[model samples]
Target: MPLDAKTLCLGALEAGFDTGYDIRKAFEDGPFQHFQSLSYGSIYPALNALLVEGLATCDVRNGDGRRDKKIYAITDSGRAALKAALMEPLAADQLRSDTMFAMAFVHLMTRDQVKRILDEYARANRRLGEELGRLLRDRMCEHPGHQFLLRLGEDGSEMWARCIEALRDDLVAALDDTREAPEAAPTGGAAAMTARDAPETREPGSGSRPGPDPHHPRDPR
Candidate 1:
């Protein structure tokens, strides 16, 4: 199931994040970060909605001496709602990658750019995999689902890094071969076809833009 901000906040409360900031951290940099994301713009509104729906409650309390803090807690109804949402059929996983998107248009980029991107992508995945592995080794997450996710993330990340490493040389070689290939002179008919396809200088025109990547994760605050 594609969970929404309200359910995400409810999950955080279930996990013991009793403050708005704490709930944000749960998705921002805490255990849920690897799989889900929510921003304040969505969080606050969802929290308010839950409150109005009698699914949550808020209490004012002392804070850092200058301002009061509002603590949030999920009601029994909220837990039931969360449980119901979780029981729904889940959508298949989606992979959205800026690096992969860039690679799709590799012919338009310089060889150096492609090399740098591949190197950085591999290093990033390796680092994330190592971090997830450490968490798994430490047994940091007690929940069976959480433990399973940590392992899944670690394995996926490591495999991606290895794949990138294995393919880098071949991709670079292909780029080199393309660059070295001679440009053949076009025949008169071929020249006319090329001219027809090309946009003329100073011509004002428009075409459809690329649609959004449906697989992308939610934007961060």
Candidate 2:
């Protein structure tokens, strides 16, 4: 089943994240790890629902006297609600994301499609890097647990952004090479099909067909 806004809001508060971004990060961090995850796409709407229900309240902190930033904390009722939710049986986890599943087909995709995917991911990562950097430099350091969390957030975001940027570079290089060199025979398909059909024969001599030699590509005979 799906998680309702109220329970999510309460759980976030119980986890000690005072703002929507903080709560979002809590889901991404290793503490929750495989158990829970959410992004701004889920956070904002749920937070708004919580506010309307009077379960949480926001306070403003002015930045450089330019614009005020709003941070939220749980109310007494919110704490009570969170405790009640925690006492309940765990619900089955459900995740739905077509964008991620599409990534499994990167090798099978057209060159243009692969390039587009990498470039899109790079842009998204760069945006996240900027957001996390701003939060660390301007806001998170002053808070308690936030300092450590901000450090983790910075490292994680930077590494992830770098990885995506590297992939984009690799794809661009492949495109450049393809423009220069003539096409070669399609590789890996026939071998992959064979593997799929007779995976148990992978050890060699376990079946009638001979397996590929690990030491050399050419046959000894």
Best by lDDT: 1
lDDT of 1 by residue, 10-119 (tens): 98888888888888886876667678888889888998999999999999898878688889999999999999988999777677788898887666666788999999
Residue 218 of model 1, lDDT score: 27
Compared with the true structure, all predictions reach lDDT values of 0.76, 0.62
Per-residue lDDT of candidate 2, residues 1-221 (tens digit): 45565677577776677777778776774233334677788788888888888888888787786666668889988888777776787677576657568766544455677777767776775666666667667643665555566566566766766676655555455433433332242446653433233323233333332343322222236
| Poorest 10 consecutive residues by lDDT, candidate 1 | 201-210
**TM-score of each predicted structure versus truth:** 0.75, 0.44
For all candidates, what are the clash counts?
Answer: 1, 0
